[model samples]
Each structure stands twice: as C-alpha cells, then as structure tokens.
Target: MRAHADAFIAYATDPDPRVRRASIEGLGLFLEDAERAVGLLQERLVHESGVAERVLVVQTMADLVLRLPAAAAPARAWFDALADSGSTDADTRLAALAHRARCAPDSIDDRTVPVVIELLRRVTPAPPPEQDPAPDDRRPSRCVHVRPRRRAIRLFPGTSPQHSTTSNATAGSMPPTPLLKALHEALGARFDDRKALLTEQLRSADRATRYDAIDMARRLIASWRGDHTDLAVHSPM
Candidate 1:
C-alpha cells in the first residue's frame, strides 16, 4: 500500500465516485504525513461527486486533524460555511449543524439551538421504514454505487427566507435515533460559567488565550483529552 500511495492519491479525484471514495478511505492509512496528506484530502472535499463522498473526505481529514490540529481551523471554517450557507439545502443545514456547533459553539445560544430543536421534532426514531436502507453519506464505505433519494424538506429554523434556500436534491436522512441521542446528551450536559469562558474562546486573538479557553472547555468534556492546537499534534509529524 505504501508503494502504491501515489496512485491511490491520484485516484481520489477519479471521475468515478467509487474510486474517489475509496481513495479518500485509503488516504486514512497515511496520517503520519499530515502536511502532504491534508493538502491532498482538502481538495477532494470540493471534487467529490456527492455528499457521501464529501463526508469521507471530511472524516479522513478529521482523522488527520487528530495528528495535525493546525489543519483544523480551515476544516472548521468549511463546516460552518456549509451550515450557514444561504444557498445550501436544509439537508446540508442538518448535516452541518453539529459540525457548525463544534466549530462555532457560540452560535449554539444564538442560532443553532433553535434549528436543532426543530430538526429534532421532524426526526423519526428510524429513517421512516422506506428510507431506512438508503445509502449512508456521512461515513465512507465500500457501497458507492447506490444513489441517495431526496428526504424531507426540513426547515432551517431561524434562517430569514433570504439567507436560506431549500435543497431538493435526493439524499437519505441521517439516522435519527443517534442524532437525537447526541442532541439529548448535549442538552443534558452540564456547564459551569459557560458564558464567560466561551466568550474568551470566541474573542481572544492570542493563540495561547484561545488555547487556554478551549482547554478549560475540554476539561469539562474530559480531563484526559490533552491540549489542542496550541499544544501541537502528537506522533512524528
């Protein structure tokens, strides 16, 4: 696989979605080379033929971010753009919601909270029996031939009509149960003095200040996670 990496990397842009997806999945095996690997994978997000393929590009990028956190700012920005995109569809809004939350947590109180609540109401325990078996998009997989059917035309809660457009493209709904569970957990999670601390995370320009703010938040998430970007990526980079 190491010897053939160049060929496989080239295949990430292949005309076939299957090849593109497999190539992205294969790229995951080379996270140690963060600069080259992330550079290669970043372009694929735009070139991917479909959302499912794009998400693989993302997931693989995420794995790389675990190795090179400096690469995260751009990816985080991309997810927020996807979420806040006025021209993007509700499915995109739905897909980008959690990620946007991760990227721009400040929006949770102002914008995303309402959008998520509304999305929760429309969500079914399953993907409606009919849509249950549709091809999964957010995860990379071997089954790339199947096409996704358009799901419901969900709302983007607070988007003033001018800021949002309805996405009519056919795509399967993300499984609702896990989504609901995650949201519920988020809702239930405890936070002490979030306003003061989160404001610092969002405002401070100093990398160290931002790092400290984020580390405080992580201490809340789990003590074992370690320093984020300001601390730098682990492993041989």
Candidate 2:
C-alpha cells in the first residue's frame, strides 16, 4: 500500500480527468492514509475547474479536514477562495464555507458565519404570494368538490422550540444539566420576547420597524424552507 500510495498521488494529478477521478475514488479505501489522500486531492484542486467536479472535491476535502485535523492548512486557502466575494455561484460558495466553518480548527477564528449568511441570502429564492382559492363554482376540492375563494391566504408555520441542537443551551452532547436546561429555556423565551417587541414596533407607525419586519419575514421563510421540498409543496397559511 505504501508503494502504491505514491503512484496514486501521481495519478491524482494526471492530465486525463478519468484518471484523476479514479484516484479520488480509490483514496476513499485507505482511511489510514490521510496524508497521502489529502496530498493527492490538494494537488488536483489546483487544476480542477468543472463546477460539479470542484463541488465534489470541496465536499471530500471537508471530510478529510474533519477526520484529519493535521491536514487543515492545505484546505484553508481553498476555503478562503471559495468564500471570496467574487464567487458567482452562491450554492457552491455557501456549501464550501459552511463545511469549513463547521470543521475549523480550535484556534481558528470564526469569520465564516457572516459570509455564509450572505451566501444563503443570495441563493434563497423569493416566495411567491399565495394564490387565492378557486371560487365555489370553480372549486376543485377533491376533484369535483373543490371550491375557489376570492381572497388569497398565506399561511405561516409557527416555530416549534422543543427541538435542540448540540450547541443549544438546553441539550448538549454531554450529560443533561439542569443549569444548562434552565439557561437554554430562558434564552429561548427571551428570543421570543424580543421578536414580540419588534412585532409591536412594526404595529406602530415606525417605518424602519416595518421594513425590518419585511426583511425578517423573507429570511425566516428562506431558512425554514431552504432544504425542504415538502414545506414548499404544502405552505399552509
């Protein structure tokens, strides 16, 4: 395996795309060869240009960095390039930056968050206004029983706060702690309170508040439905 490791690294930089692709595929078989695998992939990233191919390389590089922290430096420049302002493809840039942020080294400063949020804003498509239900005469309910309505109804799904991620105050990867749970719940409630306060501001004649509300609504919808096809299909108002 050691003898062929060098050979694989050579093939990884082959001029033929097929050989390069095969080298990437073969690297997956050797988890014990992190140095060799990453070295080979890093070489390919220099010349890789196809959108789809670069995406795959980025994903694979993320996995490598997370699994082999020692190899992170090699990927740092690539991630910086991906998150650059000149990046045109929002999806690629966002995915690359998010993966790097999640797998960053302990000493690494967290600057990728805003870049990711911006990329998310750029990639998210706007939601169209809800359609009015058909009139009673033209109703298509259950095929023949459906009815139409004159008014359009947009349904907003309420947030469910019961779920918790690892970083959430309530539940963490370690043992359950009462103090942590209390803090988490308090923070969640506080967030709800702040949102209500903004709502009240919007209710008044505050023009800025109204604009902020509009922006927040768009972002909330985008975050909730970004990766969810089901929500897109059944957005009940």
Q: Write the per-residue lDDT of candidate 2 for residues 144-224, one digit (tens) a residue.
A: 655644222211111123422111111111111111122222323233332332233233232322333343434444544
Tens-digit lDDT string for candidate 1 (36-66): 7766776776555465665455556545555
Worst 10-residue lDDT window, candidate 2: 168-177
lDDT of each: 0.48, 0.45
Q: Which one is best on lDDT?
A: 1
Q: Each candidate's TM vs. the true structure?
A: 0.46, 0.43
The CA-based lDDT of model 1 is what?
Answer: 0.48
Q: Please report the candidate that would top TM-score against the real structure.
A: 1
Clashes per model (N, Cα, C within 3 A): 3, 11
RMSD of each: 17.8, 14.3
- Mark the regions of model 1 whose C-alpha exceeds 4 Å error after superposition: 1-5, 28-39, 100-110, 117-237
Evaluate residue 118 in candidate 1 and report its C-alpha lDDT on the 0 to 100 scale.
46
